[model samples]
Target: MDGTPLILTSAERTRAARLLARFTDSYENSLTRRPIAPDEDRETLAKLLAEPFPEEGLGVDAFFADVVDRIVPYTTTIAHPRFLAYVQGPPNGIGPYAEAIAAVLNQNCNLWQISPAANVIERSIMDWLTGLFRLGPHSGGLLTSGGSGATKDAITAAIADRRTDFRERGLQENHAPLVLYTSDEAHRSVVKAAALLGIGLHNVRTIPTDDRFQLRVDLLMHAIAEDRAAGKEPFCVVATAGTVTTGSIDPIGPIADLCAKEDLWLHVDGAYGALFILADSARDALLPLSRADSITLDPHKLLYAPLEAGALLVKDMAKLRAAFAFSSTSSYLTAIDDAHLLDYMDHGPQLSRSFKALKVWAALRTFGVGAFRTVTERCLSLAARLGEHIADAPGLELMNPVTLTAVCLHMPGRNAEAHAELLTRLHEEGTAMLGPARVHEQACVRACVTNHRTTEADIDLLAERLIALAKR
Candidate 1:
C-alpha cells in the first residue's frame, strides 16, 4: 500500500474538472431563485452509498455528476429567502465563490509562513471588529467554528484570567466552588459551556428575565450576593446582546458596571446581534460592549458568511494567548520561522486550520460593510412590522417584544401540537419555513428575519397567511 501510485492521470484530471463543474452549476442555479421541493426518489441514495469502494475508481466526472443528481437535493434550502426558521440567513453573494477559491488555495492558516496573506487578512478583520466595539489596540481575538465554540473558549479564558492556579489545575483543583451567572433568556450555549468545563450544571446560576425578555439586572446582583454569602466565589457573568428565543438584549451598560464593582470577568455572547453594531440606531447602544473582557460573534449568522464562522474577541491579547497556547510542543517543524507572524494556532485550540477568512473577507469586499448595515436595518424593520401585524390581527398575540430580527407570536387558544402542525403546513405550502417557540409556557410560532433577501411584501404575506389560518 505504501508503494502505490502517487499521481493522477490526465483522464482523472479531466473527469475531476467535469464533475466539479456539474455540481458548481447546480449550486449556482439554485441560488438564483426560491428553493422548491425536489421531485426525486431518496431511497436510491442509500443504495448508491451502500456499495463498497470500487477497486477501480469511478474517476472524477461520474462522482461529480452523482453529487449533482443525488446529494444536492437532500440538503436544506437554507439559502432560500423564505427560510425564517432559526436565527440563520442565506449566504452573501460572494460566499460560495470565495469558499471555492479558498479550497483551491488549501492554505493551512495556523502559521504566518504557511499563510502570510491569510494571517494579515484575519488580523485586519479582527482589528476592524475590535474597532467596532471601541476596544483598544491591545485587544485581539480568534475565529472559531461557531458561537458555541467561541463561548466555551471565552469562559475557559475567563477562568484562567481570574484563577491564579487555573493553568496546571482545572476546576477540580481548588474545589472552591466558583460560580458563573447568566440570564434564563441567554442561549443554552452558556450552560453547555459551563458543563463542559466541569463547572457543574448545578453550580451555574440561572437568573430570571423581565417582561421585555431582558436579563433582570437587580435579580442578577441579588443572586451574586447570595452566592457570595453562601461561600461561593462569583467570578464571571455571561450576558447576551441578542438572545436566541426572543432576540432580546440584556442591559450591557448596567451589567458592565456591576462586573467592574464586583471584580468579575464579563463575557458577552453577541453572536446573533453584534453585527447589528453596524446598524446606526444600535451603534450607540452597543458602545458599552467595549467594557466586556470578551465577546462572541458569528459571521455566519449576521455577516452572511457560509456555515461555521464564529469569533471570540478579548480585550487583552495576552489573555487569549495564555488561555490557548498550551500545545506548542511541535518538534517536526522549524518553530522560529513560524513565530515571526501571528500563528492562529496560538490563538485557538485547533492546530490544523483552514482558510476560513477568505470567504468572510470576500463577502465584505464584494458587498462592502455598508451593504450589510442596510440589510441588518432592513431585518430589524421587517421584524417590527411583523410584530405590529401580529398585534393588529385577531386571535394573534405578540409573545415577545420585537427588539432585533426575531419576532415571536402566540395564538392564545391554539394547542402546542396545533402550532407545530401550522408550521409544517406553511413549509409544505411553500409559503415559509418557520419554527415554534414556547413563550411564557405557551405555544407559539417564531419568525426570524435574518436574511438580506427578505422584503416588506414577504413580511406582510406571512402575517396575512397566519391571520387567515387563525380566523379559520
Candidate 2:
C-alpha cells in the first residue's frame, strides 16, 4: 500500500456499524442485565493501553475491538436504571442519537451564517423556556456547559448590568468592594463565581436559611442595609430554586422585592428546579423567577438531555451582550452574518460553540413538553414516596423536605462517616448509587430522582435497602 493516509473504506464502515450496533445493544440490555459481582476484566486493559502509539494506524477493525474489549467494561453504567447518584440520573431515549447526529454535523454554532438552523433552534428553545417562566418579550439566553457555567454567566451579567461604568473600567478599577449574597443552601457555584470574578470570599455573604431551608428574607434585607451603611456596593443576590443537598427552594419573591428596593441585581440559580416549572405545582412555586433579572437552569438535569446542557436566561437580553460582546473579532474562515441572524459569539464568552441545542431540541420534540412534565412530576412523587418511607422507618430520619426530587435520609444514631460507609455498602451491594450530603451539619445519604427512567419500583428498592441497613 502507498504511504497515503489510511481511511475507513467500505469494509471498515460495515465493521464499524456492526460494532456500534453491538455497543448500543449492550447498553439497552444493561438495565435488566447486571454485571458480575466483583467484576473482573478477563483481558488486561492496562497493558493494551500502555503500549506505545503506532505511527501507522492499526486500521478500523482493531480499534473497534479494542474499544469493545478494553474500554466498555471498566466504564460505570450511568445509563443503568439503578445508577442514581448526585443530581445526575439517566439520559432520555433520544438524547444519545441526537448527540451522535450533532457530532456528525459538527456545526459551529457561533453565528447563524455558519449554522443557520442551529441558531434558530437555540433561539426557539430559549424563547420557549422564557415563555414557560413568563419572562416577557425581551427575555433571551445562551446555552452553557452546565449549571456551574450558567450560574457564572448569570453572576457576570448581573455585575455588568449593575455597574455604572463597567464598560470603561473592569472590576480592576478600585471601587467600594462589591458584595454579593446567597442563602447558605445555595449551590457552591455562587461562591466560586464570585471568587473567580475578583469578589473575595469575604465579600460573598451566605445568608442563613429558615427551618424549611429557604433563605430568610428578613435576614437578607438586614444584610443589604448593613452593606449599604458600611459604604459597600451590594450588587447581587443569588436565590436558589433547588439546592443541591436538600432541594430546598429559596424565597424568590421576597428576595426579588429586596433587590428591587436596594437596586441590587437578582439572579436565581435554578439549575436544578427551574424545569420543574413544567409541572403546575412547580410553576406555581417558581412565580418569582419571572421577577429576577437573570436565571440559570440546566436542561441536562430535568430535560433528560445528555450531559453538558445548561442555559443562562436574562429578562433583558442586552445585559448579557453588554457583559460579553466586547472583543471585536472577525475570522476569514467564517461567514459574515446578516442583521436577520443571531451571532451567538455576542451572547456568551465562547467563539467556537458546539451544536448543543440539537439534543435539547430533539428531546423536546420527540418527547414533547407533556412527556417532560409527566417525567418531572413522577420524579417528585417518587422522592416523596422515598421520603415518607424514610420518615416512617424506625432508625432513619429525613434530613430535609423532599421539595423537588432529592431525598436525604440519615441513620439518626450514626455520624457522617457512618452514613458515608452505609452509602458505600449500598453501592457495593448493587442496590443503588446514592451520594453523601451534609445537610444542616449532619451526614445524610442523598438520592436524587432526576432521571425520567426512575420508577416507583426503583424508589421502593432504594427504601427497602435503607430500611434493611437501618435495622441492622
Q: What is the C-alpha RMSD of each candidate to the true structure, in Å?
A: 2.6, 2.4
TM-score of 1: 0.93
lDDT by residue (1-472, candidate 1, tens digit) is 6555755677887766666666666675766364434434657767776878878877566676667667666666777777789888988888877888888898988878778998888888898899999888799887889999999999998888888678788777646798999999889899999999978888899999998888899999999999999989999999999988898889999999999999999999999988899999778768889999999999998899998799999999888888777654556534444433687787788888888888888888898998988998889899999999998999889988888888888878889988998888887787888998888998989999998878898889989999988776
**Candidate 2's C-alpha lDDT?**
0.85
Write down the TM-score of every candidate: 0.93, 0.94
Model 1 clashes, total count: 0
Colliding pairs, model 1: none
Looking at model 2, the pairs that clash are: none
Candidate 2 Cα misplacement greater than 4 A, ranges: 1-7, 35-51, 327-339
- Point out where model 1 deviates above 4 Å: 1-45, 337-340
CA lDDT, every prediction? 0.85, 0.85
- Quick one: best lDDT, which candidate? 1
